[model samples]
Target chain A: MVRNYLYILTGVLFLYACGSCGNKGASGTNGLNDIPDDVVNLGIAEISEEAMQGFVDNMSSPVEMAALIKSLNVGYSNKYLAPTDKIEDYTTNFQQAFSLGVYGLDLGYLNMYNKTNTVLDYISAIKTLADAINVGQFFDFTTLKRLAQNNQNLDSLMYISVHSFNQMDNYLRKTNRSNLSVLIVTGLWLEGNYLATQVYKEAPHPALKERIGEQKIIIEKLMIFLQNFKSDKQFQNLISELSSLQEEYKNVSITIELGEPEAVEKDGMLTFIQHDKSIVNISDETVQRITQKTEDIRNKLIRK
Target chain B: MRPYIKTIFIFALFLALARPAFSQDISELTAQCAASAGDVTYLKDFPAKLDAGTPGGKPPSAKYSMLLSKNTAYRFTICTAPDSEGEAILDLYDMNILIGSTYNKATGKDYPSFDFKCQKTAVYHIFVSFKEGKAGNAVGIMSFVEKL
Candidate 1:
């Protein structure tokens, strides 16, 4: 009887272990479904979804941009953010997804300045847009609202808010809605750049200027991803609009110099010192042109 | 016979209780790891649950591609799950080159996290794995340190 009981217990453990193994398999390609049937059938050859995902994934987070702006002592301004009242105007999934990105960046900016009071408006807007796109499950609005109400939990709020968006993006890509994912990414990039450029117009910080110029690399990659979905008229229009902005970026030059890598172990933490340095050369004239063109493109996208 | 049945029932109850308790521990572990990132702005989290590979084979690892900007300081933090026996290591690579790692092989030491001051605007890869091909679960967090 003892032996029999032991056998049963071992069998139960084996099954439990097997249950955990279910997650291992080929990654689902639900994202491919987002591609238009025409593009797939016509053999126009869209970039692999995985490659596109990599492009979207690598874009710098808006929070980083907001943090840098705050670090430069730039005062928080609501003028730079897409107005929350216009959420209803974003009827189309394209517009909603794009606006979601815009508001997401705005939320980052607000959080950076510790403007928790105004955060609820943006959070509501984000939740509405996310729900419209069927990715609302990722955001816990209740907890976010609670966190936003308390300044002490700013770090937790930031982490949860960023994590929520990351989870939503992953879900969108995992499902077949990468098209929306791309738009969100583009929207975030546009808003982040817009905030930086607009602030530079007022403050004119050199670090901020160089940061704006660095978008030359980012826009190049973003354009490639947008071009992959050029089969759609919306994407085509975006590509056309961004092409002008991309042209403006041509004047901004960036070059890198490799340096010896050094590693330091301090207080049980490893720090890898990057020796490579990049030289960004952008004239004020070019920045002005980029700024004007960024405003133009961003306005067109956000306008009702 | 009754005693044997009681013993089996108790064992089953323990198994049911342990699963959720372990899951809760992992959740707490992940939260603690995220908190350990300090005042840096959180960017993304990479959750990896990996099993040991074949004997004498390369250890399993999770790889994520990130677009790191030029002149930006980024921090990578790793935390092993409570139930895991293996300690997780994170490696940052630019293409084929290994640029940084949490563990220094020669010194036989492991660090909880590492900071990378990226100098180029390009796509980089991060790999997370356990030492010596051991099975484990861990959460890797990437946080923005500052603009360097």
Candidate 2:
């Protein structure tokens, strides 16, 4: 009887574990859960608490970290939006607009994530957005789509994720303890570059290469700050896993051709060939690669 | 065992509760007063709930007194709905200019804000109301602010 009772108790515990840990249900599209909780809070903290709730004010969905930069009044020279103050408004508005423009993909990704709250959902939404791009539903912003086309599907997603992560990366590097920030940013930075490589293989864009090079500069700066966290196990493990993934995608390149390449500038919009469509069609091999990286990172973080 | 599980669980539960609670914070009132037709006023007895679902519902209506300023911009922003069935309409007038009007299907975000530049500084009367027929526990007259 004692043995039977023990068996029953063990079975109950097993059942609870299984039920609690099963594939988290379809979280819609945003995959917010995949992000570390502290990261999310910190990301939201980047946006001002007052401005955080006013999505309609911007006429666009919010990217928590990016929006936080606006709320910090980091770049604002003038306090209010009176027409009499041209220089301040021009500088502030231009900076705000530039941030908004640069964050298009990030905002879209966040919206897609909020609309659907899981990894698969986010992937699905990206695929849908890709399909929309394929069908010409996107506004023909020459430069924006041009930046997107370099990676095809996964590449753009990677870019969006990486760039968005970089916003936090920059903030963390600036405000927080250098050691902890470097460890986390380095992991995300490598992860960004790794994912970029996969998209690069599908489609190649020279401008994206330029951006990637810029990202490298940031990463190198981060590396200098890494020595402090060298002994931290979780940080070390994440960094190692991210490095491995980065190494795997090291050679992959994304190729893109702007329909009117010369007609576009960072200030302009252009027609972009679909580079990321291939993500929707990624094969088992690609799945294995991503899953391996994801699992390694998860294990490192989840372990006590 | 992770010590933070219950803490995280309770926190999550609290946020889930807070989201709905915040959305339902809007209220409709009965503050009606007499002023010129162009004047805008805050509606009294706001937060009138709208219908449950399926269109063909009336937007909530409220009369405001001396709420409209001649040369200022006024806007309405909504916060919550019981379900998906609620609808709100906002109309703006400036010295009979019929400056702006909008309608929105109730979701969790603010909506239907009307904007127009005011030409005069006199008090202007404005009207806001729900569609005559609707059903649901929707919040009405979420909030309105007029800026000069």
Candidate 2 docking class: incorrect
Q: What tens digits encode model 1's per-residue C-alpha lDDT throughout A275-295?
A: 877789999999999889989
State the lDDT of candidate 2 residue by residue for A152-199, as single tens digits: 343234334433333332233333223323333343333333333333
Alpha-carbon runs more than 4 Å astray in model 1: A1-49, A56-58, B1-28
Per-model lDDT = 0.80, 0.33
For candidate 1, the TM-score of chain A alone versus the native chain A is 0.84
Per-residue error for A84 in candidate 1, Å, reads 0.8
Candidate 2: fraction of native contacts reproduced: 0.00
* Candidate 2 Cα outliers beyond 4 Å, as residue runs: A1-110, A113-172, A183-228, A231-234, A250-287, A302-304, B1-148
Quality of candidate 1 docking, DockQ: 0.37
Q: Residue B87 error for model 2, in Å?
A: 46
Q: Which one is best on DockQ?
A: 1
Worst 10 residues of 2 chain B by lDDT: B28-37
